[model samples]
Target chain A: MLRFIDARCMLGERCIIREGDPNTKEAILELMDRCHIEKAIVYHAMARESELPAGNMALIGETAGDDRFIRQWCALPSYFGEYMSAEDFFDAMKQHHVTSMRLLPKTCGYSLRPHSIGKLMDLAAQCHMPVFIDLGTELTTDESYDLCKMYPEVDLVFGNSGYRENRRLGPILEQCPNFYLGTGNYVAHCGIKLFCEYYGAERLIFDTGLPTGSATAAVSLIGYAEISDEEKALIAHGNIERLLGEVRL
Target chain B: MDFRELVYGQKPFEGVFVFDVHGHIGFEQGSQLGPNDGESMVHTMDRMGVDGICVSFSPGIRGAWKRGNDQTKDTCKRLPGRVFGYAVPNPFHAECDLTPYFEEDLGFRGVKIHGNIQGETPENDPRYAHAFELANRLKLPVLFHAWMPYEVDRAADVASRYPDLNVIIGHGGLTFARDRAVAACKRYDNVFCDTAISSAPDGSIEWLVDKVGVEKVLYGSDMSFFDCIHTLGKLALAKLSDTDKEKILGLNAKKIFDL
Candidate 1:
């Protein structure tokens, strides 16, 4: 059996949507078990609409004793010292053992363009860390393209990209090697096969957008794809694993 | 079972009997995509191990209701046991008669109403009353293309009016429509939601089962437009017990459509 790692999951109650269950660590672990995911990289759902430090702390507290989870900190712009300076932020990540980072520029009041987040992007690039941005929420395709160009050394993964965004994503894949796609809601027919054929499996990572998306659906896309087992392994866990291993923290 | 076996093995879904409640047949100019003919649909079904499908004609739903219905009947005739027809009635065209299609020999198992495509007719629109009445009279389940909460509410309204009619909210009311879709099922005994494109926010399937009981949820793959394997995999790998999985996979659909 191929070991699976979910690249995206949330760990707290979402403020806006009160429809589903609260995403506590126990709930996520049970979900991972249900979908046969071996490990997950999780951030707190509160980060999408709350203070970054508090949300990150909540995430740290929730997964303090759990090894199955890899903590991802929600980052904010360092304007007026709202978040820490780039250096301090990196140190905090090391201290907290956070392997990945996510940015909600729109909800958190910032922009992906260098003018707003340039220093942070530079720090991320220097540290060889992965930064995740969600499509339709934090950034648009063009904005993601600009960020990828600005920080070639920083690995940027775009999450929550559905079928409608594929046509727009093709140019980014062609232009930016540092740019990657999170396959949580990627529902295009034969999308995994086509993605691997065009951009290589290393640029695609497995993510379920869990607690808000289907892990099995994401897994089935890669598992049942016409790609080879080696490619499946890379997309399923190896690619994200390689990125996490390269994290300076 | 191994992941590979569950997905790509010879009998990919060996033990489960999958009955897809939402499917489309024949091509539509608007979508400009489909292997929508019967043979292509069956070919895909065989590949995915879909035991059966309750299908409507895409062109029929778009505009050519009668021609599309005739084409669906022919397709169902071509593949009797596998392809079950859903009669599409254009409420805008009152001349559109659905009576003959529901007859015993015609083999239509249900009715499909698209409010979005059919000029956004509310479910309570008097023009649709005839079709709903026919469905109630024939004991056929009605599948409504519900994309919003209001659409689901309209379905609940019509369902309440015709107590015997089984109303299925297609796509599980999709996107922002999920909460209301669940409420509709909880409110009406005859209302059920199909798991077609509802594979979002992780535990939604388990949540739905928990809220409304497994019996109120049915497995539907918006196939040809969407992948059957994707929806099937969602249900197959959900956290529900095997009994619940069995019901969502085929049992509920089998009981609802009498297939």
Candidate 2:
């Protein structure tokens, strides 16, 4: 079985949920076990939905004894003393063993421009911690290119892509070497093969937008992709391992 | 079928009958799709062990209808049993007649109504009545792009009107309209749903099967627009019994399409 490290997952309760969704942490773990995903880079729902600081702290409490979850925290620009300073946030992350950060520009009512997040991006670049965000919610497909250009040194991994993003993503893939995409919902036919052919597997990150996203479907896309075994390894776990391995904090 | 082992081994689903009920070919005007041609789709199917797929020319629902359908006809002709065609009707074209497509054994198994892209026309709009009537006469399946609650209702209305023809609500089972889709499946005998969406979570298929028996569910990959492998794997590893898995994967479609 190909081992997977989910780059995107959430804990805590969500506002809108369906009957069969894996909304709870235990349900998410059951899905991870079934899908052979060994570890997931996880965030808390409260951070994104209700409160950022409490949600981040809640994530620490939730995944306390569980080594299966690689900790990730939601970030704010902290312009109005709403959150910790960039230095203090990174210090807290290092203390808490958090290796990555997630951005919620639209959800938090902030901008992605360097002017708004320059300090956080600078700190992220210094530590080599990958910054994660969603495609449609945090920003538009067109703005991904701009995000990559603005934070050239910091690696940006965008998740929650649908099938209809290739026309917009093609140019971004070509121009932005720092931009990586989450493969959870990027289910376009032969999409993985075509992406591997053009951009190579290094830029593709394996993720299941878990609790809401399908871990079964996400793993199947990579396992059944018409690419070589080496490419599959890279997408399934190799690239993310490499990305997280480089984290200084 | 040892579906889990097959997925772990990354092997094709040999020895199992797998047929996709929702698919699209040709180009998408709104976005770029990967390998949308018949040959490319077949190559993916070959890798995944899918026995057959029914596709509609995506562009036909919006642009010139005849050319779009001719494209489907040509693809179905070239591919034979492996590829089947869905005859699409242009709602704007008053003279549109899908009867000719069904007259021949050109592998046209059903009708596709994607009214949302066709000026947001209702699924049971009067313009689609003609095609629905023909499908009813032939006892064929009519697949509707019903992704919303209202769209599911419209499709259910069609099922009420045409008791003979099966109405497969595409992308409705695991979407926001799932409750509506389940209600319709319970309310109408001919109403069914396909697993064609990209964003539904795990256990969704199991839930659908629980709400409306596995018989009402069919495997639909939305290939070319989305890969078949993901949805296929989802069914294989779903919490349902192997028998239910088989039924949803292909057996159900086999009975519906008369394959």
Candidate 3:
């Protein structure tokens, strides 16, 4: 069985959940076990949906003793005094053992430009921590290109990719080497194989986008893809393990 | 078939009768796609052990009616049993006639009505009445790209109008319009939902099955647009019985498409 480490997952309850979605942490774990996902790099629902600081702290409390969940905190540009400064946030992250960061620029009402998020980007660059963000909701494909260019040092993993993004994604994938894609919703027919042909498998990260995302479908995409087993391993777990392993903080 | 084992083992479902109801072929004008041709789809199917797939010319839904359908016909002709055709109807073209594809067993299983792409045409628009009439007469399945609640309602209207034909509301099962799709399935015997869409949550399918019984749900990959493996895996590992999984994967589609 191919081991999986879900790169994009949310912890805690969120508003507007459907009937049978894995909303609770326990439910998410059950799905993880079912899908054979050993670890999931997760952030807090409250951080993305409502409060960033409180939700980020809540994530630390939620995954306290569980090594299965590699913790990721929601990041906000500290231009305003709304949250902790970039330095303090990194300090807190190191203090709490949160290895990665998730950006909610659209939801948090922050700019992705160098001026707004430069300090955080610099800190991330200094540490080589992978920055996580959603494609459609947090930013557009064009903006993702700009983000990769803006912070070339920080590896950006964009999730929530639809099947129709190949046209926009092709140029970006060719241009941005730092850009990595989450395999949760990028279910284009033979997309994984074609992507492996053009772009190497090291760029694709295995993710379920759980709670709102489908772990079952996500695993099946990589599992049944017409790609080589080595490529499958790179996408399923190898790539994510390498990315998380590179975090200096 | 030990569906869960297949998923966990990362093995193709060789023994199970897998047939996809919703599919698209030909290059998409709006976005880039992975190998949107008949042979490429068949190659993927072979790798995944999918028995058959029903596809429509994606560009045909919006562009020239004759050429688009001709493309589908050509593809169907190229791959006989593995690739089935869905004759698309262009709402703008008044002289549209889908009878020729149906008249001959050109591997055309059903009629595809993607009204949303054909200039936002309503699913139950009068222009589609011809195709609907043909499907109604032949007791064929008419697949509609109904993603919204309004679209689902319009499809439900078509189901009500032509009770003989089966209306498969593509992508409506897991979209925001799921409740509407479920309601339609409950109300109308002929109206059914396809498990398409790339962004649906895991349990949404189970909820859909719970709301509208397993018989009402058919496995739709939206293949060539989306990969069939994910949806197939979803059904396999779904918190449902093997019989139900078998039904959604191909059994229901087999009966509906009369394969």
Candidate 4:
């Protein structure tokens, strides 16, 4: 069996579409089992639409018992003490055992500029935690590139961006070694194969964009990609495992 | 075969014939991404293990309808059996004539109508009715690019009017509109859905199959616009029985297109 560690998944109720199962821990796990995903790094779906503290706490509470799930919290600007300060957020992450973080700046109402997220980025860099930003959501590709440039030590993982953005992403990948791409929406023809060849497998991580996206499509994109097994395994689990292992929490 | 076996190049479905019902030839404006020509299309099909494809011309959807149809016909003629043509008719074009192409000599399998692409909406347009009428008269399936519920409903209304005209809702009405597409499929026997979008939100395909039998669904890559392997992978990884998978992958297309 090919074990997979899905780096992107959400847990909570989605307000827009009521077709699929509720984005609960049990439901996510059931989906994982059905899709043959062994482990997953999860965030709360509420984080995208709700306040950061409430959403993050719900995420921590809901995913308490499952060690298979690597907890991911939502990051927000520290303006007016709405969210934690840089040092405080880092401490909170350590205390809560949160290994990774995602940003929804647009939905959460914040900016990706240094003035807003610089402290968080610095702390994340110091602690070796990976911060995920979806292109066209929390940040555009250029903004993400700027963030990577500012904090070269922080590992920036881009997700939810489709294959068409590859031309835009090419320069970012070439310039920033600390950058990574989540393979949830990388559906370009020979995209995985080319990414593996050009950027090495370590820069790519397996993700399903589950609940919102297809776990089957995610698995198939990597599994059917004309790449070697070694590369596949690395993208499937090793890269994410290594990133999680480096988390000081 | 298991997912692992299929992904590992086992060719578990060696004998099964796969037909891509929705695909495109030619190029899109301002985007140079794809197997635009016949040679590249064949190369991509070979790589993805697709036995055949029913293709439309992109230029026809934009403008220059006749030239694009001629190009598609020529490509299909050059690669007989492997390549099939979908005559894309610009309903807005002053000289939109599809009669000759539907003849046996042309060997075009179906007609493609893009609602939003041609600077017009497909619902309640007189040209669309005429085109649908032409397709109904010729007893050919009409693939309609329906990205919303209203479009699917409109197509369904037309299909209801012309019971023999098989109208396929492309991309399964995309993400937000899939349920509506499924509803349309259930309501109308002549309505079918194709999976061609970039993403396959969880349980969407399964829901389609469960709501409307596997025979109402067809495998479509929307290739050149999208990757064939991606759609193939989506179908391959769907939690379906091999028999159902076979039907959705190609058997349904074969029956619809008579390939």
Candidate 5:
């Protein structure tokens, strides 16, 4: 029996313009149930609080109650002071087994500290935590390339890098070897075919960014695009397995 | 396949004009909308079944320019049979003597105005009045970028002034009220409502047809920015006949834009 997986699924809504919408968890699960996604790492949108690690921990706590999925630590830098002395960052990383910090410097209005970034990288090195940064912000996709280059070991998943002209990202794909992309919204854009062909298909992963019915729709984009099933299987699950290594589940 | 065939399964979809009404051309390369190159829009129009459109953008043209007309010259040259591009003018660009450009250069049949996207209050801006006057003189319609609780009053004010000018209030369905568009259309003969992004739970097409005549309504799917097929699916559940659907789908736009 073979099981497929979506490594980059977020537990929260991806749209920044409007709020009060439902998060991506139920939507992701429903889309996954419809499209068959197993073993997704979900995050929370309720991280506006001062103590974001606590907010993230609360999400982890909520999902700890559920059997179908697992929650990732969504760290807000404002909450970093509460728990982030490199030691505490590792403690939370170990406790929550956080694979990513959903970075939002423009929306969160914070700096990625030299001290924090180094220690965050150390924890990522120690615990293998990858950070998912939404490139939908004011930061250009080329800037996303810079961020990925700065911390090459810590896997950076670029989301909403640009809506259609995502092909501009082709140069970055050629330059940055370790960087990966969150595939939901990206696949819908017309240039996705060339992107998969140019960048190794393994460098891409599927995401719903769900609650916008994006996950389910995105599945079809990957399913129907000119790419082969072998490449899609890598994007859908194999690449995630390679990144995270063997886990108990 | 041709535009009619792409949408309606055949050509000679008699007297049908499927106007996208809302479109963007020339978004910068590697940006969200592909590139600002010559070939982008022609490729988009062919794939989307958009026969004609009145386009405006968040960018592409500088603030104090007729970005709409700037985009029009290229779209017409590229997809001559498939598109009739609209000349977009904002209050900032002071070109009162646009008749020559309208007739000679751009050959635009209509005008597109985006108020909210540019972060302006069109009601207070007198520069738009100049645009309205030019449209009236040319016997051309104006399809305005609008939404209720934001740009409704501006739409009504312009529509009331030029009774013959076909003023299309782009997104008029109030998520709250049923009679708002009806009351506005009743107030002005030129004003007509487009059932756009307001294709939500409350503002259904049946409610719009009940408020305004079927002739007054036009269908538009905000593609690239929205899922076109899914949006078309939403209207499939509306309480209207196949003819009503056909008219809304293409015929009404044909009549409205004179395609």
Candidate 6:
């Protein structure tokens, strides 16, 4: 089954515009049309920064109804009970057919610094789900890598990778297993080579934002990428399929 | 993963000898290197299909000398062939200027100083000017971390006096804010703009390439951290000829640094 995931590179709770970017729903359909992506996992800033995870919850709930896509919610583990109790989180996921969770510990100013939300994270792992976050910042790389290494059972994906810092990843990925990558910030120059060389194709997934840089443009280089077809399939479809396969959405 | 192979068949990148004028390695935060380092950066060169790079350490002085030096130095020692070095000279460090930066540092080819941009300088400090002259005599290109519109005069003065020296104005001088990079490049032939931070302010890289010619524009992923991808990738969207693309990517820095 060929499928595409909307990695949600950028979304404004309010409208912020890139010259060629499309709106949320339209962007996804265009991305699917362009790349033959049948399914996409969506992320949004409005949901992420909500006073409650309610915004994220609502989006997931709405999208879960669509067979063409899966809804992923942002869980502020640090702000847990306040935003939504763990029970509410479960309820929302179950209610909306939410398949996964995305975390933004740094941007949300939450402390993934060992001292905060230990139990909550452990509980999420018990539920068996994936956590996707934008690791575009410097600190998040170490933290994400370290955290994944620490919690081998937990599945994590880092989007908006620091392209130039691709070299630093080999050691980190070598140390941290069970980690995956989403490319919203990938460029043509040596980006595919770097990702394939160091991280292995098993971990790379196509998650570029739609419309503005829809899968057509986003996956163009990816389609022409030199990695093996099986490997490319994993990046293009398989890995993400397996990622969702684990969750009961 | 040779650069030629990666960029092959890519028509928009037809320019010969595109110089990655503003390449960097080394960490930025609190690690042995801060955020990104040379070793960590090498793979990206292959990924971006970059032919070669003139590397610098990560951004900010690490708030400590021992840490900062190690971060910058380690990149030079390890990736001599794959990368070039730029010393982060904090001129305020009264005792040590960029002298050792000239000699003894074998692999390192140039020097970069970031002042006030990190809340460190008053822009007109004499000692900073001394560092500029040191780079001049050493034939090392200097990338200073001071913005324009506010500090245009400072950049202009340095470039005019050291017309023979290659002084790149880091960060597009407000990316063509009030001082405007195009006007600045026109004013001083010796001065170049590091596109790392300049980027497409109003019209994208097309405007910069149009205004200053690709030779004066260089690619910088400032500390690179997470921002380098977008910084360098912006060029891909530019509507320049292939020859121009090569110049902006690596050849310009090659010509300037004589690499």
Identify the leading candidate in terms of DockQ.
2
- Tens digit of per-residue lDDT, candidate 5, span A164-216: 53556777878887688877655332444556766778888776554432443
Docking class of 2: high
Q: Per-residue CA lDDT of candidate 4, range B1-259, in tens? A: 4533574452434557889888888877754454467777677677666789889988877878889999999998898888898887676775788878876756588888787877766654677676777788877888888877777778788888988879999885455687788888889999899998887676677777887888899888887766677777767766678888888889888877877
Cα shift from native, residue B162, model 2 (Å): 1.0
DockQ (C-alpha) of model 3? 0.88
**TM-scores for all candidates?**
0.88, 0.99, 0.98, 0.92, 0.66, 0.60
Tens-digit lDDT string for candidate 1 (B175-209): 56888998889899999998778346556778888
TM-score of chain B of 6: 0.80
User: What number of backbone clashes does candidate 1 have, counting pairs of residues 3 or more apart or in separate chains?
Assistant: 6
Q: Write the per-residue lDDT of candidate 5 for residues B24-112, one digit (tens) a residue.
A: 55553334543333355444444444455545443533353545455556666665655556665655545534455576745366777
Global lDDT scores for all candidate models = 0.80, 0.93, 0.91, 0.79, 0.57, 0.59
Candidate 5 DockQ score?
0.10
Q: Rank the candidates by TM-score, best first.
A: 2, 3, 4, 1, 5, 6
Off by over 4 Å in 3: none
Candidate 2 ranges with C-alpha deviation above 4 Å: none
The per-residue C-alpha lDDT of model 1 at residue B251 equals 86
Which is superior by DockQ, 4 or 6?
A: 4
Model 4: per-residue Cα lDDT over A1-249, one tens digit each: 567999988887667755553355676677787667998888887777755688888988888887888889888878777667878877888898998888788887777778888888878877889998887766888887887898899888888877777667889999999889999887765678778887899899899888777786787777766688889899999998898889875
Model 4's alpha-carbon lDDT is: 0.79
Error at A178, model 3, angstroms: 1.4
TM-score (C-alpha) between model 5 and the true structure: 0.66
The per-residue C-alpha lDDT of model 2 at residue B75 equals 99
| Model 1 regions more than 4 Å off | A16-22, B1-11, B25-44, B66-80, B99-107, B173-183, B186-189
Better-scoring candidate (lDDT), 2 or 6:
2
